[model samples]
Target chain A: MKPQSLLVPALVAAIALLVMTDPAMAYLDPGSGSYFFQLLLGAVLGCSFALKIYWRNLVSFGRRLFSKSRANRPSEQQDGPE
Target chain B: MTGINEVKGSFRDPAGRMFRRDGVLYRGIAPQGLDDYSMLMSSGLYEELCAAGKLIPHEEAASPQAPTDELRFIRPREIPFISYPYEWCFEQMRAAALLTLDVQQAALARGMCLKDASAYNVQFVGPRCVFIDTLSFARRQANVPWAAYGQFCRHFLAPLALMSMRDARLAALLRTHLDGVPLDLAAKLLPKRSRLKMGLLSHLHMHAYFVKKFSSGGAAASSKNTRTLPRNALEALVQSLRSAVLSLKSDESSGEWTDYYDNTSYDAAAMDQKIRIVADYLSSKAPAVVWDIGANTGRFSQVACEAGAYTVAFDIDHQAVQRNYLDALRSGRGNLLPLVCDATNPSPPLGWALAERDSLTARGPADAVLALALVHHLAIANNIPLESICDFFGDICRSALIIEFVPKDDPQVVRMLSMRADIFDSYTPERFESVFSRRFAIERSQRVGDGPRSIYLMTKR
Candidate 1:
C-alpha cells in the first residue's frame, strides 16, 4: 500500500524488461538459465504466497510463543521449594 | 466407441495407459508408476485431493488386465465432456493453470511431484478444472527443479500471455500447436511492454532467449549446470506464476454478444416462458449431461444445470463465455462449464495421431442437446444447410434434442439475411422438421409465446 513498497517491484520489473527486450527467435526453453531463474522466482513467490495462505496460523504461533515466554519468565523469577 | 478402447493420450506416461470397457474407464498402471502411486494412496493425498474435487478419484479394479508386468488395474470416473485448452476462454485457461499448481503444491506436501503438468492432463470436472491423469505423480527428489516447469510455461503460460498481451482469439493457436503455443512465438507475438512484467520477463522472453542461445546443436554446454533446484524455489516459482496469471485477468476483450441477453428481442415474460418449456423438457426426461450450443451467456444453460444436469455451455463469443464463467465462479455452481466454441467449425481432434484430444462430436452423444435460438446463425449467416445442421445435431445427441427454429421474419434472422441475398429457401419450419424427421421423431412442439421462434422436443429414431 505504500509508495515505497511499490518502488522495489517497479524497479525489478523495469530491469527485467530491459533484460528481456532482446528479439531472440529461439524459444526452446527446455531447462535454460531463464527457466532456472523462474524456478528461483517461483520458489520465492511460492513461499510468500504460502506465508500469506497460512498467515493466521503464523500469527497464532507467534502469540502462543510470546505467551509461553511470559509464563516462563514469571515461573523463573519466582523460585520453587527446590 | 466401447469395449477395450485404448485412450490415445494416456500412453505418453509410462506410469499408465487408459482404456474403456463398456462405459467405464480403466487405468493400467506400469511397474515404475506403482511405488509413487502407492505412496500417494497410503499418504492419503489422493483421497484428500479427490474429496476437495481438485483430483479425479479412481479405484483398483477387482480384476487386473496384466497382473504380472503391471502393479494393478484401476477404474477412473469418466468425464462428462472432454474440452481442450483451445476451446477455453481466458478465465477457463487461468483457472486450469491455477488448478495444476494447486495439485502440484498439494503433491509436494506429500513427498510427491507431478511428473508432467501438460494442460491435456487437466480437464473440466464442471466449472472447475481438475487433474485427471492418475499416473502423473512421482516421488519427489531432493533439490530437484520442477521437470514440468517448461511444459507449464508452454501449455498454460504462453497461451495466457498471448491472450492477455495480444488478443483473446489467439487461444485458437492451441489447435495447431498441440504441445502448446511455442514459447518463442509467444515471446515474439507478445507486446514489447509485456517484457516489463517480471513473470513474463523471466519465464517467457528471457526463457526464449536462453533456449535459443544455449540450445545450439542439442549439446549446449550450459545444460549440465541447470541442476537441482530446491523445493522451496519450486514452490516460489509456482506462487510467482500464479500472481502473473492472476494479473493478466484485465486483458480480456468484450465481444458484441457479451451483453447479449440484455439486448435480446425477447421480453422478460417471453424469456421466462421459454425457460419453463426447456426446464420441463429436461425434467421429464432427465439427462446426465447437457450441451447448450450457442449458449450466449448461459441463461438457459443455468436452467439445465438447475435440473441437476452437468451442463457444458458453448459459445463462439469469448467475452460471453468469460462472463458466463465468471458467473459460475461467483455463484459456485460446479454443474455448468462455459467454453468458447464456433459450432460451425467445431473443435477437431488434434495432437499425437489426431487422437490425443477428441473432436467436439466425438466427446458427445450427449444425453440431451439444447439448440435454442442458434439455428438462424448457422443457416443464414454461416450458410450451413438446414439438413446438415440437423445431421450435425443427430450425430451429437444420443437421446433427446430441444431445438428452437427461428422464422425468417424474426428480427435476428432478418438481420442475418439483410447482409446478403436470402438464398436459404428450405429453411422454413416445415422443411426443418421434415429434414430432421429422417433422424428424429418429434415428441412435442410449441410456439414460444407470440414470438416467431418455435421450440421442439424430439427423440432420436
Candidate 2:
C-alpha cells in the first residue's frame, strides 16, 4: 500500500484508541496515533535523505559555475544609483 | 545635622542625601524640595496616596530634625522586599513601565511632574505596581517639555520595545544597562521592520538620531533655548507613551516552561487534596514564612498566605509566574509574592561585587518548603537522584517538607517516557522512600484521590 493512502485510516484508528483509554493510574507507552505518525514520518524522512545526495552534486555544479564567473570580474564597488 | 550612610548611584538626587538610621531609610529633602514637601503632605495627598499604595508611605519626622531654614525631613516605611528592575520578569517589567508613566501622569495632574522616570522607583506591592520614590515629584515648569521624557524612553520604552520587537530574553538587558539601555543600541538591535511603526520610529529611532546629532554640535546646545514643547503636548506625550507601553504584550501565551503543569499527574481532586493537606500541616506547624517551590498558578501559596504565614511562591515557568503575579494584583494579595526562579539554577548573589541583592539560597532556609509535585521532574527529567533532592531540601530549610511522590506506574511518568527510552528501571515508590528516608523522616503519606501519586509531609531529621 502507498504510504499516503494509509494516512487517513491510521489517524482515525489512533484517535479512536486515545478517546477510549483513560490514563488515571499510569500513562500509556504512546498515545494511539503516535506510532502511525512516527512510521509515516520515518518513511518520508528516508526518501528525503536519499534525495539529498543528488541535490548536493547539483548545488556544487552551480557553485563552480558562479565562482568561475565571479573570479573573471574585477573586485570593486561599481557605480550604483543612490 | 546628624548624618547617616548615603546610598550611591543616580539616587544622588535629593542632593546625595539618602540616609539609613536604625535600619529605616530616609531621604533628606534639599532646601529646593521644602515647599513641595509641605504641599505634598499638608495637602493630605501624601497620606491619601500612600494609603492607596500609589506612593511610598512616609511619616513626618517625630523628632525636630530639620535645619532652622529647612522644611521637615520625613521617613518613609521601607519596602519589605527590595527587588531591582533587572530581576523582574517580563510582565513585572511591563507593569513597572506602565506604573512609572501612571505616576508621572498623576503627578502632572497634581501640578507636579516626576523629576526622573527611573524604573527603580517602582516595585510590586503584591501584584499591584506602586511608586516608591515619594520625592521624585517636583513642581512643574511651564513649557519645559517634560525633562523626564528622554529619561522615560530610555528607562522603560527602550527595553520594553527591545523585548517585544527583538526577543523576550532581551529584558535581561536591564541588568547590564542600569541607567536604561541606550536608545541608539536598542534601535540598532531592533529589526529594520520595527522602524516602520510610528511610535518606535519617533520615540526610539528619531530620538536616538537627535541625541547623537545634538550631542556632537555646539549650535544644538545653543538651540536648547528655542526648543520647548507646550505643557499640553507634554501631557499628551506621557499618555501616548503609557498606551504604547501598556499595549506591548508578551509574545507567547505560555512561557518556555508552561507545559509542566499539564504534564503533571494531578487531576483537580489530587490538587485539592494536596492543598488541604498542606493547609492542615501549616495550621499545626504555624511557621512564619513558607516557600512554595515550583508553585505553578499559586493555588497552594494562597493557602499558606491565608493561614497567616507570609508565603514566597517561586516558579520556573514565566507564564505561571506572570499569571500568579497578575492574579495577586487583581485580588490585592499582600501576604504572598511570586517570583520567577528556576529552582535548579536559582538567582545567585549578584550586583555590585555580588552583595547588593541576596541569592536564592542566601535568601532562603525559610521556615518550611512546599516541594509539591516537583520531585519527579527533578529526579527523572533533570537526572537528580531522589536522595540528593532530599539532601538539597534539608540544606535549604530547617523544619518540614511537604513533598509529593508520583510513582513510575503513574500516567505522568509514562508520558515523560513516551518519546524516550525507559532507562529509569529503578524509579519505584519503595526505592524513592528508601533513599529519601535517610534525611527526612516521613511524617505522613496519603494517596491523592484514587491516583497512584501520594503526598508526604516529611520532617527534617
lDDT of 2 by residue, B1-461 (tens): 46545454324454225566665776667676777676666666666676766887877675344444334557777665556665566778888887787777767777777777788788775666788777776766544445556667777888888877777667667767766788789889988987777667767787777666555445444433233333344555666677667767675655765665566567777777777888888887787778899998788899998988778888877677777887887887887778777778776666566655456776668788898878878888888877778778887777888888888878877788898887777778898888878888888888888888887878888
Per-residue lDDT, model 2, residue B171, is 65
Residue A76 displacement (Å), model 1: 26
Mark the 10 consecutive residues where model 2 chain B has the least summed lDDT: B222-231
Tens digits of lDDT, candidate 1, B83-160: 899989888898889999889999988888887878888898678888887877788765555767778888999999
Q: Which stretches of candidate 2 lie over 4 Å from their true place?
A: A1-82, B1-11, B14-36, B42-48, B62-73, B86-91, B165-167, B191-193, B212-227, B256-263, B331-334, B355-358, B361-365, B383-400, B405-454, B458-461
User: Which CAPRI tier for candidate 2?
Assistant: incorrect
lDDT by residue for model 2 (A16-82), tens: 2223222111111211121222222223333343344346656777898999878765443342332
* Top candidate (lDDT): 1
Alpha-carbon DockQ of candidate 2: 0.01
State in Å the error of residue B81, model 1: 1.8
Task: Give the residue spans of candidate 1 off by over 4 A.
Answer: A1-82, B1-3, B66-68, B217-222
Q: Candidate 1 at B422: error in angstroms?
A: 1.7
Error of 2 at A73 (Å): 82
